[model samples]
Target: MPLVTTTEMFKKAYDGGYAVGAFNVNNMEIVQGITEAAGELNAPVILQVSKGARAYANHTYLVKMVEAAVIENPNIPIALHLDHGDSFEVCKSCIDGGFTSVMIDASSKPFEENIALTKKVVEYAHDHGVVVEAELGTLAGVEDEVVVEAGQESYTHPEEVEEFVSRTGCDSLAIAIGTSHGAYKFTPAQCTRNEDGVLVPPPLRFDVLEECIKRLPGFPIVLHGSSSVPQEFVKLVNTYGGAMPDAIGIPEEQLREAAKLAVCKINIDSDIRLAITASIRKHFAEHPDHFDPRQYLKPARQAVKDMVAHKIVNVLGCDGKA
Candidate 1:
């Protein structure tokens, strides 16, 4: 099937109490892994391209790769999206370049400026038959080009959501409740220790989310930086000559609960990166003579596939809902 906008998908997710996974794609293997798993499970998927991804793998290449996935898996729906678009030009380029959806993340700007910029993008995107997502709050952590310090992050004010949506006319809204941008989402000080000596991050502000839902009433909501940062992958990476400490993420149960509410799209990028890095690290440790990229990338791709499948069946709960 051809690419589809998130309009119908979000409507279904809102009614069905599940969210679609928006996995960021950087390369051929990553695209193949995510789409393959989604295809097998008969789930609709969103392949998102970040500005860094467009810079690393040219925009044409990412679009073509997603188109190829569309051809290879005709049974399930696929949407190409631009993640965290910071400017009108960025969102317009994606909309004109065949992306089914785009996000305008002007949350860091003044409230009025954000609404104006998002409304501009929304006008352009809607004219081109595409849907737009806008963000209202700043999320903490570093993810690609987006970085905000811990104290600097602010949760989405539930009071402002209705006004933002009414003025911007964005198809969906991405809000910050507690989830942040990267793998190291919380510092050691912000988290407490669990029985296994693992750091448990602070719980999400579901009260805030519930208030937003009550106000928006049937409108689609989105969660950015939703990766669970699987502990297994962290241990694997550390064991194989990598050093990353206190890399925590939002708990999966919290995300699951959010999905059952108004959240229709959950952005997960760090988990894919972690899965790939962990596999490549382990492969290099086991095979010292491996030089060809494919030698390691093949396994790395499978790691991505496995991780995405787990998310589909377990975390997002969108399997068989295509």
Candidate 2:
């Protein structure tokens, strides 16, 4: 299948009561990992490129990688998306460059400014047959260039959601409930103590999530910062001589529950990143003489594939969703 807009996917997710995984991709391996997993499970996927990603890997490379995935996985639907485009210039560039969807993230601005900016992007995007996702609340996460400090995390205001969507004319809304960006999502102190003294993070504010759903009704909702910090991956990182203490992420059960509601798209990136890092660390620790990047990258790629497949089957509930 050629690249498609999220319109059909989101509608199906809303009607089916499941969420599609919108996995962020930066490089060839990352794109391959996500699409391979989605293909095996007969799942539709959204591959998104962040502004930082465009800076790291040139925009042309990112677009071609997504194009390659479409050719490689002809059976599953793939939506090439621009994640967290900060300005109209960025959003317009992606839309004209053939992205299937774009996110105009102006949530940090004042309400009126945000609406105006998002509306501008929506107008241009719709003209080009692309769907747009607008944000009403700020998510507390650090996905590359998007850095939200600790105290800045704010939930989406239920009161303003309708107005934001109506004014911006967005196809979906990205809201902040509790999930944060990156692997180190919570401090040990912020989480609850488990039986073994390991910290289990607090459950997401489902009440707030429900309120957003109520405001939007059946409209598609998106959850950013939704990675599940797999403990096994963390342990592997530590065991292989890497030191990342108490790296945590949103719990899978909560994500599963959200997928059953108005959440039609779930964004994930950290888990696959952790998998690649852990595999590389383990491989290096086990083989000190290995200098070939491919030797370690191969296992890392497999790790990414495994992680994404797990997210599709367990958290996002996108398996066989295509």
Clashing pairs in 1: none
Q: For candidate 1, what is the total of clashing residue pairs?
A: 0
Question: How well is each residue in 52-167 modelled by candidate 2, as lDDT tens digits?
Answer: 88999999999998999899999999999999999999999999998999999998999999999999999999999999999877877688888998778888888999999998
lDDT scores in order: 0.95, 0.91
Off by over 4 Å in 1: none
Provide the global lDDT of candidate 2 against the true structure. Answer: 0.91
Each prediction's number of clashing residue pairs:
0, 2
lDDT of 1 by residue, 76-139 (tens): 9899999999999999999999999999999999999999999999999999999999999999
Task: Itemize residue pairs with steric clashes in candidate 2.
Answer: 1-74, 141-181
- lDDT (C-alpha) at residue 198 in model 2: 83
* Model 2 Cα shift for residue 14 (angstroms): 0.9
